[model samples]
Target: MATPIQMPSLSPTMKEGKIVKWLKKVGDKVSSGEAVAEVETDKSNLEIEAFDDGYLLQIVVGEDQMAAVGAPIAFLGAKGEKVDAGKSAAKPAEAPSAAKPPPPPAPAAKPAAAPPPAAPAAGGGGGGRIAVAMPSLSPTMKEGKIVKWLKKVGDKVSSGDAIAELETDKSNLEIEAYDDGTLAEIVVGENQTAEVGAPIAYLTAKGGKAAAAAPAPAPAAPAPAAPAPSAPAQASGGGQVVPLRREEPAAAGGRRLRASPLAKKIARERGLDINQVRGSGPSGRIVKRDIEEALTKGVSAPAAKKAPAPGARPAAGVRPEPQVVPLTSMRKVIAQRMTEVKPGVPHFYLTIEVDMDAAVKVREEAKAMDLKVSVNDLIVKAVAMAVRRYPKINVSLQGDHVVQYSTVDVGIAVALEEGLITPILKDADQKGLQAISTEVRELAERARKRALKPDEYTGGSITVSNLGMYGIDQFVAVINPPQASILAVGAVADKAVVINGQLAVRKMMTATLSCDHRVIDGAIGAEFLRELRGLLEHPTRLLF
Candidate 1:
């Protein structure tokens, strides 16, 4: 029997991965659990193994191209078996989110306008008791594990108070109460898993009877419905698809090919050699029509190009094709979080330029002392010290409250291929420059590998985003939520400046602080930057 080998989920949050290379070519595979192909996800490059022992019959997705999770990448079959890869492979489904305006961030339980009360859900009782079910804490969360219960039976629970903690698909978030009541009965125990909307606990009014609820296993299992329902939508959205179409070699008869982006993408995906395909566009540029015609009406494919000489540049007038890259899970989460946090929260940016000559000299001296201090490490140290002097800079703008953290945990933004992740240097103000340097490097390396645990990335009071290494003069960064401020650090380079009275060259850097106006007022943000500039300019102050 011929079976299709589907793309595997390589990382915890990977939606897709690029096919790096196939280790085994067609007719070469024979063992189960053997490595077949290498896949490169945003996190790391890993080899995907074959589960069944069979001959490698066909490659569905080619090298250097991306495939969504569960999309077929190859076909396997017995020796001399005919593998109908096209029939066995499932077509990539169209995304429904593209048609709908981005829904409110999945974390926000209710939309901006809370809807009117519904007829009674699973947990509603007669005596002012509403059932508190296992909540859907993250998008794509089906069932959740209850990490701990915050409120025990007989405890008074206030509306909007966190009653339990759940470990969801993304992160661990608390379950909040919807009505004021007493915790009457715990339906689901801690460490137990329950379906979303299934009763986890029951809350009742004072002297009110508890509601009897059953946490049934049956929710009709809607998981399989997603793959089935999207086929019609995918077929309806005709122009959007490229991978679903199969290709065949035609008789040699067509014009030279210089393909359009759409035509080029289609050709690349379908494994078509459109180099000599007939074109109807300007200057004989191959269009989608040309690709379709070539598949059906044959085209004369151009011979493979000769190898270029050593150190030679790429051919002139040969531009890479512009194609679509779907959003990864990390990117989608980032987009959702940013869209949710950026608006509605008032933001203010403050920029300051500082003399970096002294700090630069100190860094050189540290390097001589075998210290691994870099520009970001210095900024992290400075920001940490600044927050200590002005605690308002290390605060979170919670709803109707400002939380000023006692410890200065500075977050360093590490860029990934698909998105940005921050890993914290806890108690940064208390650590030495060398210690900060080492920790930042380790955190960043792990972050890039997506190996950092949830605790390592979360709970930072303030974040430092440095583009100085990239030679950026200055840029503002959006404040990470719950975080009151983000400091953007630019390059430390020589510039002509007036010191005392004479115009001389000095190392100078620009730093911008983006603040949530609710937590940090304009003056507070300025004062914090002033304190930061003093530390960096003096250099000696940061040594302690």
Candidate 2:
């Protein structure tokens, strides 16, 4: 009897793979240990061979298509035998997205081998446990540290409750339950690390036989789940059934402001202090209607002075006894990314100097109005405005696709004791100088306290790394992966230069832009720098 050969799990973490190409054709003779097709896995592309001697009968899954682990890809059988695929008991496979045209009728052969059986139920909730796995908190994250467990074994939890807080590469994130269940077991303990997609805990369905665990059909993969609970869910921070982030009053310096994104954007645009408009939405969350009402009530926006940079503690001598300190998640990610970027990615550098006298004058005027405007704030706004002209530099290379982002989201790299995190200033191109200044200050403060959410620090079109506060004249920065360019801003110091063909002292800052050669060409990088330099030099134009 002809049998379907299921797709094999080449890598432990690979849930599915794209069929790159088939090495054999339909009706071709396939023998055991013969390579039949190539599959592109999560890490790399490898050839999948046949496990049994048979003639190729039919290709169940086509080329350029994806098949889930343990799904059928092709059929294999003895010569002169015809298989009835339609009557086969296997569930038909569907394309994840827009299905590509089926590959030309060619030699259909057996898969390299069958996938291994699923692992035993986690949390010891055999056949009924809803195991929660570690999700990828950030795009480049491989694993996460279990900071602490909010729920323990035998504790009943409702849908949308935070089960645990996982320390990711970028920030500390809370993973919530999608369905009501009792925590059956804790597979990973506090202060330990687990790879993404690895089970950290298990849950038993509500009213189940025991508080042990439930199977997939029972409590996993809820209809409304973005990362269905059955698998290591993507921990969207907040999902529909239960919100990870409650719209409670979050600290903005001392004042707590809770508002919807639309309301905040409207408030920022109207130059109104959102804090003045009391929220009337759920849990006092300010909505768009509230902002409109406030506008009608003649509420004006107030410019907040940027938070003062915290002063460093007094220098103390090292302790007499030496001890090794464990590396943080941030530090570990930085080390891995730094190691891969140097040798794997090609980089080209471009340096440009800007006269900050105009920017300096603007800052002084802002200070007179009690607004805290810094030199870096000006650069951030300028870069945001500059990227609008050349959108290619603001795109990311995702697999084979070049994803052009819709907004000029700029990342402001904030230095911390453990490491550094780049908090995204979303839609910076549309924001005013005051908004950028205040937002950056607030983000830096949260970053230092390790209170930032994943969305705040990930997915930026470009990054601005300024070392001017450290008294560094100029230095190039390594490119953050996937981003085409990173701007390195240096200190504004008195330098002798020929301006208008005359030697004069001017406050000049040198900026170096490190660009990835694969995504950005030299011409595009130069144009962006030229535009940035112009915007910073003519500081007044940035307002328009």
Candidate 3:
């Protein structure tokens, strides 16, 4: 019996996956639990393994192809049995020229052997087109510039291999090829920008001979003649082309020059376009190396008028110029989620000051023992212990029910190059400070590199965001959706306080807990924070 191998749902949020590669080909024997293919989800690339021992029958989804979750990607059959090759593979012939006309086979022209049917063009080979969309490089990036392509038309690309580099507002990011296939076409060019989700290229599963043949004769035509000089001059000046004057010189000789005092001043400062420089100073007398100095400085020549400040209303005669950028997929999601949380959930914040002298001393003691635990790790441990005592704060809003989690999965907010991401430290209460610190560091490093798996970013019962390293005295963070509260930790500071009627300086830290009103009321949230403060103030409670 043949069993259809459907694309497995690797993550709860995964809608589709791109086939990275097939480890086994048709007719190869696959054992249960053996990796058969690699697939890339939105978050990470995962290996797809075979579930049962069988012969590889067919690959329905070619490498680099994307299939919706649960779609058939391959098939398996009994070992040694013939497998269906589907609609591809050539059919067997009935007979080979029954009445063969022999003799005098030599031809005058040989017909050029039909040019051996030129190999299918890179991306057009497959009958169907696979759209390569512009990738969102950052959470706030709405569009990206196609800086350059790493793969050209007809080049074969494998999964995980960089296909192009995209420039977002934040930084340049390498985009990977989703499937293994010939790059069919490049719809976007270098320096050209496109919105996220827009098609930047196309990939065909099979090479297209017809499309490949279409460009063979394109280079035969001569290049178009250059446009008239005046046309370019007007366009460069941001104006419509004007007819050339009858008295104008047929050709402007080398360095046809002129300059003004203001032009020279601007030139010295900016390295301006001297030839295009217009002098506002007294009668343009080709002032002392004006244009030359400007050109050397590379500064913008004087404009006809000054530009207004950004977003400022223009005068009656002028309309304000505005630049528009589309919202990127990541940015769009962030905006939507933020709006939903802001208005839909009633939020209340509780702030408390904790004495961190003991906590710092404990950390110093741990460091002496070769355990370099961070203040964050200490806070995480304290929060986990507090949650164990006050479980109500470690719950999420799930429709009519408040889902309380038994185990503590603490989400430590990390700032990545792309944006903010929170990776979980599971069972934080069960782990020691050193273990939590190591895991948090590893997760943060991975988050910055966009290498975190979906599981790392999901299933956290609580979240913690700290800006103490940055010297933030105090701040409050919105609760992550579904989760009841988020803890914001501020920097530890020395403050003068009255202890038993004596003024003394003590190390103190401020923390603010933002709770979702539906899941955690002010009293419950405050009690949790009080417990956390007590643990930090005592420092030994975390160990117990």
Candidates' lDDT values, in order? 0.61, 0.64, 0.60
Count of backbone clashes for each model? 1, 17, 18
Which prediction has more favorable TM-score, 1 or 2? Answer: 2
Residue-wise lDDT of candidate 2 within 420-529, one digit each (tens)?
A: 88999977887889999999999999888887766577668899999999999999998776677899999999999998899999999999999876566788999999
Which sections of candidate 1 miss by over 4 Å?
Answer: 1-343
Q: Please give, for residues 1-544, the per-residue lDDT of candidate 1 as tens digits.
A: 6675666654445565555445676567557767677665544445677778888665555443455565555667877765333233332311321233443334122211111111111123335344666643323446888889998999998644668877654445567664567898998899998875566887775432222111111111111122333433322221111120011112212312234566777778877776545444322335666678767754333322212212232221121112223444663454456547766555789999999988888889889998878767878898899888887677664433345565677999988786787788877887899899998999888777655544466668799999998999899999877677899888888899998999999999999999876556789899999999999998789887
- The sequence of per-residue lDDT tens digits that candidate 3 reaches over residues 441-525 is 9998877766554346665778999999999999989887757789999999999988899998999899999887655668898
TM-score of each: 0.42, 0.59, 0.48
Question: What TM-score does candidate 2 reach?
Answer: 0.59
Candidate 1 Cα deviation (angstroms), residue 105: 31
Q: How accurate is candidate 1 locally (lDDT)?
A: 0.61
Of candidates 3 and 1, the better by TM-score: 3
Candidate number achieving the greatest lDDT relative to the actual structure: 2
How do these models rank on lDDT, best leading? Answer: 2, 1, 3
Off by over 4 Å in 2: 1-127, 207-213, 216-343
